[model samples]
Target: MHSIHSTDAESAQNLTRYLADEEETLKFGKKLAACLHSGLIIHLFGNLGAGKTTLTRGILHGLGYSHIVKSPTYNLVEIYKISGLYLYHFDFYRFNDYSEWEEAGFRDYFNSDSICLVEWPEKAGNLLPKADLQCFLNMFDSGRNIEIRSSTETGKQCLIHWNTEKNI
Candidate 1:
């Protein structure tokens, strides 16, 4: 496992890279999915082609969802039922106004029975629920950089578990 401690937010922002071939990335996502609980919100931040969807695909695969996973950019949300878990994958890329979040009544989806993974969450402003984990993805020349930050105590525990399990 790799461990680095930053004294400040800026230092914490220094990126880390994982050259996870598809298999490894899937494995990582699966590991993360296993630790998830309902009502968890994962905020994904990345520019175009940063592999957010790829990571989400991994998560779905890990959750035992065999169907094809596609970005919900146009549809706004995709609901998946897997092993009694309601996983909502949301992509707000096409969102033009924050009011749409309210108009769509998306806040109701943040209940204790569902897990939400939101891409382009910035588009929702304060309407969206608080995220448990914030995952930042960045594009490098050859691979991707992934940084996971815990927004809540549960998220911190999840990261600690992942670090231990994956020896990251």
Candidate 2:
């Protein structure tokens, strides 16, 4: 995995490293979910079996979704309503044609009142909107390494909350 260092001095601005175990991964996801709001878009990047689905499950659980959360590999998209937040999970792993995104009319789902999490976002090419947060997961010796970058102001705010809550 790649080693990263951040020079941002703010307590909320720093690089955090954690063991890539399942529990720790879930904890990170839950912490991230607390700071999420409507209209948020998160792009997930990782190779196969990098735990994207696990992290997403944690996010859905944190959002108060009692039902089982599954990857949208086959369905392409899954919608859930929890705690007054509209959460849309999209998996583009099977996406071969860029036109499928528009043909499916998924862009309309990114409203000001919903949160969208997309996996394999590159599969959509230039058809998708910019992500608020871009998370890259890499496989390591023991497990995985995740690097999260704030792509927008809202994402930066979420990072602030994550930093404060985790004392990172």
Output the number of the TM-score-best candidate.
2
TM-score, per-candidate, Cα-based = 0.87, 0.90
Candidate 1 accuracy as TM-score: 0.87
Q: Per-residue lDDT for 24-84 in model 1, tens only?
A: 6666677678777888899999998788888888889888899999989889999999989
Q: Which residue ranges in model 2 land beyond 4 Å of their true spot? A: 1-5, 9-16
**Candidate 2 lDDT, tens digit per residue, 80-132?**
99978899999999888888888988989998999999999999998999998
Error of 1 at 35 (Å): 1.8
Name the regions of candidate 1 deviating beyond 4 angstroms: 1-3, 6-17, 20-23
Note the residue pairs that clash in candidate 2.
none
C-alpha RMSD of candidate 1: 3.1
Whole-structure CA lDDT of model 2: 0.82
Residue 156 error for model 1, in Å? 1.2
Clash count for candidate 2 is: 0
